[model samples]
Target: MDTRIRRGRRALVNWLERLHRLAPAKSVVWVPAGTFALILVLWIGTISRIQAEGREARQAAAGATSQVASSFAAHIDKTVHDADVAVRWIKYEYERSPSTFRLDTYKEKGLISAGTALQVTIVGPDGEVLQTTTPEAQPVNVSDRRHFLAHKSSPDIGLYISRPVLGRVSHHWTLQFTRRLNNPDGSFAGVVVVSEDPDFLTTGFNNLEALGVGGMLVVMSDNGYLLSRLASGEHASPVGPPASAYREMVDAKGEGFTDPVDRVPRIVTYRHSTQYPVAVLAGISEKVALAGYRHARDLYILMAGLLTVVLLAAAAIITATMTRLVAARARMQHLAETDALTGLPNRYLLTEILRRRIGRERPLDRLALLFVDLDNFKRINDALGHQTGDELLQNVARRLVRVAGNKSFVARVGGDEFVLVVEGMDVAVAARDMARSIIDTFELAFGLRGNSYVMRVSIGVAVYTAESETEYDLLRQADLAMYAAKEEGRSANASRYHTFAPDLAVRGMRDIERQQELQYAIQNNEFFLEYQPIVSLDTGDTLGVEALVRWRHPEKGIVLPGEFIPFAESTGFIIPIGELILEAACAQFSEWMESDPRPLYLSVNVSAAQLVHGDLIGVIRQCLERHSIDPRRLKLEITETAILKDAALIARRLKELRLLGVRVVLDDFGTGYSSLAHLTNLMVDGVKIDRSFTRGVPGDRTALAMFQSIVSLTHDLGLSLVVEGVETEQQVNWLRRFGHIEVQGFYFCRPVAPGSLQAGRAA
Candidate 1:
């Protein structure tokens, strides 16, 4: 999963790089385009919503107007029915007894109300007014009225309603409701007319609050003649031509249209009376009906516009920042792939180049990789300052580049190692010749700080085979050949360069296998410890023990330290193996202290790799704390080589250990250079004599003298001394001459398991 994620990220970076290379400005243009698209979508959605709300508002308005129209129609029908009943009573009384019938009599009895009509009159068959309810009882001719003419012409006309006209007797505009007066012979006699004011019908049914501003309530005849109309809280006289569509319309329905009277867009509904020849129209203006919808729609558009502006600004800022970041990342990637000091391709880039070259579609006839390593570069670096070493390495890089020319690629892969890829070579001999040329060129001394120092480099040449080797395999092979060259250079008749042979491949494979085995051994807990007693020569009593790690290989039975310790050290497996040893030794010593009252200290060897790379001090502190052992009871044994790597750092670590009350001793004392200086400067608690010096003690006088001198030096310095490689009683007896010297060898006890060691063993 991690590999897949890394590949995906790399692919994305590559794509971006290509885009930037093609058109940098065009890459950010999409931000504005995307913003515009988003705004368009917002506007489309908002407008659609506004339109939908407007439709709903219109529907609601239409429904309200329709309801108002229905109510108005019902009221008008009732009023007309009541008026017809009064007219029939008047007609019946007149027809029954012309002598007794009188308009004043009906008015006195309260049967004829002024609310229903303006005046009531009886017209004789000659079309002249005979009796009237109005104060003007003057004689008048009413034969020309449509109501009177219709009733006089036909006896079948029950009740006739006339359009608004000027009353002959009252001299006012009124709608006449008339019934025929018939004699006992079934012939028309005269007309009974009820004069009603047209404005009364509209005023009686007006609902200004429900209709709103610019609303209308109108009653019209079936012939399209307007009877009564009220608009915007005011009575209106019918002036325009009758609406022909209203006359043709039979069903009660609602619609939106422009009103002819006011020229206003309105939602209008029409309801026709079932019994009467009249219809009611209720209308509401569109502007008033959709006022709220318009407000909300405007608000939505404003908010959307503001949001679009903010989003576009943010997108612009983000695009600018991303553009700058992309440019910075390209520069950083170049710097990362190149070495800082040498200004050459680093290991990471070297691997990629090698992979690409090896994975090409067309294979080269002969390809070679040269692994170059400086001889004793670390010694030169340590003897002189690192700055000088760096300058020297740079000079070497220039020289190697010169030797390789332009055809080959050279890269610095490590502090003192460089790799060169030679392609297009015709034969294997050419590759070897190139390696020889590199070695021969480096034979000259490098000039630094006005000093001419001869620097030798070992070169290893590995030729590529088709379909058989990978980039890693080539590197490994070249490295192995380089080590072989260094080994050969140790002899008198030595060659400074070597080509990779099949034997070197075998050796490399063995090394790889050994490293794997060591790793497996550490992981599986296959390594165990055996403690060797450090006996006090004065009292012949066990004072302390040194812990030695041995690997119990599953296949090789019991593997001794001599076989795998150096391998483990070189491969960095020693750190974990050393940790295991320290933990086991501390635990075992704690157990011993618990069972027995002996105040014996435990000494665990510290490897060079552990001192330099691993967190030695923290590991020791944890071990001491975990086992609940006194710091003084735990001694760490370090070789002079470990201190030589970084003396100041090691000294400081040793001082911290002393502060913890832990003792630090130099193991194999006499073998390293400046031993006495280390003893004084490093503040060591004790020093152990190398086994070589003790092997010849009492037999070889030179060895005895050296051993005695070391002992006297420790005693004089107020430092403890332990002699290693004590074999027979003769050596132990000889070591007794050196008073207060401790011996650890087979003479006292061989290294054994925790169960085998006796508590009070004395030599």
Candidate 2:
């Protein structure tokens, strides 16, 4: 019947019905919904008991205190009124016979004794020799007294009550009630005083059980001057200081007031007598008033709660089997989207989360995806049992969660592979550092079973782009970078990470086609050579030509070496590819000598792979011998790094070629290894300055100084010099100032097909 319980139960039912939608359509109603409903009903029943008990406790306390106050005021008002009537009678006697009064006679007649006041007295106008109700009274004056001075001056001061004082006649602490006496012509006579002992109010208080053990009855002046306080069966001494609790309420001329008792927050019920100067305050114990009600209410609540729990238990037992079935289905659904080994989100959840992020993303809002794969994790699985490998994966997943925490979302998408998604502006800019932290998580060796295994991971990162890129595109880019890191062996030492670039995706697609068609291109003679003339800057005479290759893809027109050269080197296709260039260059040299001989030589590029794997010297000798060309006319241009790898082997090969009359020229000199490791260690005929340096010499002072230093170094070595990438007149002017040197670049002529270029001068 309680409205609160009904409302709370209705809300709980609505929420449970909505939760059923998340469960499968034809399955038994979501079993947790029943459990939730049971809990809500019990909770509402308990709250109803608390509210009802609290309201009854407050109302009972208030009603008890109000009844006590009314009884106290009625008793107090009669006492004060009797004192007032006796004082008025004493004044009439004084006026009937001035200067003489029989207060003793009145006491003997028992008129004052039957009154509320203890004694009555009369004072002279000179304020001396007061007639008090005592057979043998000692002389005493009350001129310095408050009640006496109040009545002596004001004719209508009415009845006045003084602060509690000990009387000279009665010899007890008393509150003085005084009234002014006036002559027949309205002149001041003296005052008639009556004493109220205050114990009279507590005459029947000990038998009133409703006051309880700690209840207080206080009678104080209207001005907050305390007269007396009867607490329990004892009275507070009249000599103590005055007290006030409801000073604000009492000072206002209201009929009566209540307040917190003694500032302890317990309520004081007060009522003022209508015909008297004093007010009555009765404070009943709140606990005493509500004691019986609370005991009965608590027992009822306890009994009801047990009943509710019994009903809830019966409902749970009826639905127990259904609940277990629903829980099993929910667990199965969770396992479907989770990795069993690592307990991390699987590929399905990863795809869902990434697509959801993209769907809600705003312009310029970026997301970084990092794909991490343990390098050579297969080796660990083969060495250790699957149980040990599974343990290791679990530990790694925990470490990833610890390192990234809530800053990024991490998921395990495959065996020994994890993905982390971090959202921010251009987060890929911080990709290297974030990636390094992930690698550092594996710094300590992982303990599995009884053995320790050290694992390292390679991370590839991709950042989102604003235009046309989907979630799948970012994932694919990150995967490509991961394989590149493993293939390039970049993660073996520093960085241990690779970031995706737009060109990497382009190269990735091109490599697929190139890897499939590369051998075909070499076998069908689809490769051909292009030559760029090497000329002298001052004389403008062509001294040599460099051989470059191109693939004329049937469908895509001519494909540059940049498109497939790195792919060839990685696949060892450059070895066969290099042979074609060497033979073509030697054959061209023979054609030059026969047509018009002027000691022209042909230079061919040697890749780092060819120098490492191929019989470079044998290939050159065979070409020279086959074309019937002199070895002097053949030159091999090698990069500085090509010799840095296996320097001993390349150096020995270079010597054999040199002895056979072939010249070795260092190509792209200023770009790599500025420390002269290759120049000093290996014998070379000349140095060719890289285009990056040649292009900057006319504008950048640092490039100019570097060019000057290389020129001085080669001249000091007594080696020949050739500068490439000389594209403008400014560059030509600068080189001419440094004296005569061989130069070749676009300023002279671009590379052309074999028969298109003359043997001597460019263009």
Per-residue alpha-carbon lDDT of candidate 2 for residues 1-763, written as tens digits (9 for 90 to 100): 2233233234423433433423345544444466567667666766676667766665666566667777877877767777778888888888888756677777777776735467778887767756887558888887888787887778898988788888877787787778888888888888888887856665645435767766667777786677767665467777654756445444232122333333322335767878777887776544455567667667767766676677567656746766676688669866886777766667876776666557555324367788988885765765576877787787877777666545565678888888877766667665666788887777778887777777777788888876577778888989988877776654254326788888889889977877779888999878888989999877888988888899988788898988888789888999999998788777876777788758777888888778768888788778888898878877788888566556676777888878999889998896665536667878888889889898787889999888888888888888889998999888898899878799998898888987888655663
Give each model's whole-structure lDDT. Answer: 0.80, 0.74
| Candidate 1 structure quality by residue, lDDT tens digits, 1-763 | 2333234335434533433432343466677778788889988998899899988888898888888888888889988898888788888889989989888888898878787579999999989998999985789988887778888888786778777887888888888888998888977788999888988787777555788888887788865677877777777664444645345333535577776767677788888889977888888877888788889888988998898888888888977886887678767866887677777667887776667666653245467888999886876787688999998887877777777665565778999998877777574677788888886786677887888877777788887875667788888888988999888885433438788889998888899999988888888999998988999988988999889988899899899988988888878888988889988999888889898888888998888788777988899889888989999988888998668767776777788889989998999898887877887888789998889888887889898788778888889999988888988988877777777788898878889998999778565
Clashing residue pairs in candidate 2 are: none
My TM-score estimates for the predictions, one after another, are 0.55, 0.39
Question: Cα lDDT for residue 76, model 1?
Answer: 92
